[model samples]
Structure formats: C-alpha cells, structure tokens
Target: MANPVQFLSQVRDQAAKITWPTRREVVTTTIMVFIMATLAAIFFFLVDIAIRTGLTWLLGSVS
Candidate 1:
C-alpha cells in the first residue's frame, strides 16, 4: 500500500499528464452541445404532441 506522500505524488503526476482542451475547442463543442440539445428537445416535443393527438382522436372516436 502506498503511503500518503507517495499517493500525493502519484496524483500530481497523473494531473500533469492531462491535456486540457484549447479555448476554441471548448467553445465550439459547447455551442454544438447546445444546438444538439435544442434539436432533441424540439423532436421530443413534436413526438409528444403527435402521440397526444392520436390518443385523443382514438378515444374520442370510440365514444
């Protein structure tokens, strides 16, 4: 088992090995995420509306 000092050293080494994204890359991906989220929300909303309408029509016709 590693002692506290060795564990901290290993953690520091791992942290240094990380390659952070550039500002432009971060911004581009953030925008893409927002666009994808908006599209998904719109698609789900349309699907929900279609299902609701179909169910309503079916129930109404049965009465």
Candidate 2:
C-alpha cells in the first residue's frame, strides 16, 4: 500500500500540472449548460401539457 504522505504529494503534483480554465471560459460554459437545461425543461413541459390535454379530452368523451 502506498503511504498517505506519498499519495498526498502525488495528488498535489497532478493537480499542479492541470491547466485550469479561464474565468471567461468557465462563464461561457456555464451559460451554455443553463440554456440547454432551460430548453429541455420547456420542451418537456409542453409535451406534458399536450398529453394531459389529450387524456382529459378522451376521458370526457367516454363519460
């Protein structure tokens, strides 16, 4: 098993080698994710409403 101290040092070294994203890049990516999520939610909401309306009409016709 590796020693805890050695494992920690390895982790630190790996982290240091990573090239972190700039603030602008992070913000743009975040905005894109939000836009996609919002569009998905809107699409699902419309589908749900359509399904509910169809079911209600069918039930109403049967009664």
Candidate 3:
C-alpha cells in the first residue's frame, strides 16, 4: 500500500494526464444539452395533456 505522500504524488500524476475539453466543444455540448432538454420537456407536456384529456373523456362517458 502506498504511503500518504506516494498516494498524493500518484493522484497528481493522474490529474496531469487528464485531457480537458476545448471551449468550442464545451459550448457545443452545453447548447445541445439545453436543446435536448427543452425538446424533452415539450414532449412530456404534450403527452401529459393527451393523457389528461383521454382520462377526462373516459370518466365523463362512464357517468
């Protein structure tokens, strides 16, 4: 098992090996995530409306 100093040194070495995303990549992904989230919200809203309408019509017919 590594001692504390050796473990910290290993961690530092691993951190240095990380490849961070470019600004353009980060911006593009952020925009895509927002767009997808918006589309998903719209889809769920429409589905909820449809289900509610269906249930209302069915219950009304039973009465």
In candidate 3, stretches whose alpha carbon ends up further than 4 angstroms from where it belongs are: none
Per-model TM values vs. the true structure:
0.87, 0.79, 0.90
Candidate 2 residue runs with Cα over 4 Å from true position: none
Which scores greater on lDDT, model 2 or model 3? 3
Model 2 C-alpha lDDT versus the unseen true structure: 0.99
Q: What residue runs in model 1 are displaced by over 4 Å at the alpha carbon?
A: none
lDDT of 3 by residue, 1-63 (tens): 999999999999999999999999999999999999999999999999999999999999999
Q: Per-residue alpha-carbon lDDT of model 2 for 1-63, expressed as tens digits?
A: 789999999999999999989999999999999999999999999999999999999999999
For every candidate, C-alpha RMSD to the true structure in Å: 1.1, 1.6, 1.0
**Candidate 2 Cα RMSD (Å):** 1.6
Among all windows of 10 consecutive residues in model 1, the one with the lowest summed lDDT is: 12-21
Evaluate model 2: give its TM-score.
0.79
Ranking of models by TM-score:
3, 1, 2
Tell me which residue pairs clash in candidate 3. Answer: none
Residue-wise lDDT of candidate 1 within 1-63, one digit each (tens)? 999999999999999999999999999999999999999999999999999999999999999
